[model samples]
Target: MSDVRESEGLTLLGNQGTSYPTDYDPGVLETFQNNHLDRDYMVTFRCPEFTTLCPITGQPDFATLYINYIPHIRMVESKSLKLYLFSFRNHGDFHEDVTNVIVNDLAKLMEPKYLEVRGLFYPRGGISIYPFANWAHPDFGYAELARTRMFEQLSDLDRGDGTR
Candidate 1:
């Protein structure tokens, strides 16, 4: 188990006076050392209130952002993750772009063995958009898993199942 010292760099976790960012800022993210590097496990985060603006219309877009990953040596702090997601409230981007950006940011942040981000944006014009992005480290033997999941999501979409 990790001692309290392992979490010393986490500022937003317990801080009562955190100033939420007003723009898209990946800098707000913070991580602590993963205690179980010896074993591989999945970590999932669901942000049901994720909000962002449409770049063209400047209208609000609501989504439930799902982030799943297999950690390597570090794990993101949940409070910091919440604040980071909240930072997107005023940022403008397309659904696909936002999902890809999240996956990229988190992939760089943790360099995890495997990572994936899915954004299920509510329909704005009778057309719902769910974007999915994923990556895997070459050394972790997760490339096939990523490919399989990607294809599975695509299949589900084709079946109108909305499994993602």
Candidate 2:
């Protein structure tokens, strides 16, 4: 679901985020479907077909991820972030590693009250794996933040896909 085919340095296309993996396998999809919706503030962006080349195999690794977080004051600039994330295209890492790397990078940038990232990797070798990770800031309003997975009722979506 890339909005711009070419990268624009620090700038990014205001294109909606898309999922990177879908063909992984059926099991992965089923895991995502059955997973709980525990989250505080939720923002879902559908990167319908996100791709990142494997550093080892030189093949693309894919996933549909849901990022949920409660912000404090600082916030991520969407376009810039889109570019930052897309920079991973030629980068290779395991699903868990990539998902965690993103969450950590974002936490450092935005330092939100709470954050969670769920990577629904496509099924590989009959295994559909979804890696989920999150972070919580102890600095401010950390306790009163909404911490629930009730996903269906989430009010907004970057589209309907899960990112940011």
Residue 123 error, candidate 2, Å: 1.5
In model 2, state the lDDT of residue 64. 69
Task: Give the residue spans of candidate 2 off by over 4 A.
Answer: 1-42, 141-164
Compared with the true structure, what per-residue lDDT tens digits does model 2 show for residues 1-164?
A: 24222322222233355444322221111100112234445444444454565567877777766666666554555555555556667677787788788788877766777777776667656775566667778765554333543342243333444432
Model 1 clashing-pair count: 0
lDDT of each: 0.88, 0.56
Model 1 pairs in collision: none
Cα RMSD (angstroms) for every candidate in the order listed: 2.4, 11.8
How high a TM-score does candidate 2 get?
0.60
lDDT string for model 1 (1-164, tens) is 23463545776766779999999999999998898988999998888899999999999999888799999998988998998899999999999999999889999998999998878889898988989999999999999999898867767677654554
Error of 2 at 81 (Å): 1.9
Candidate number of the best TM-score: 1
Worst window of 10 by summed lDDT in candidate 2 = 25-34
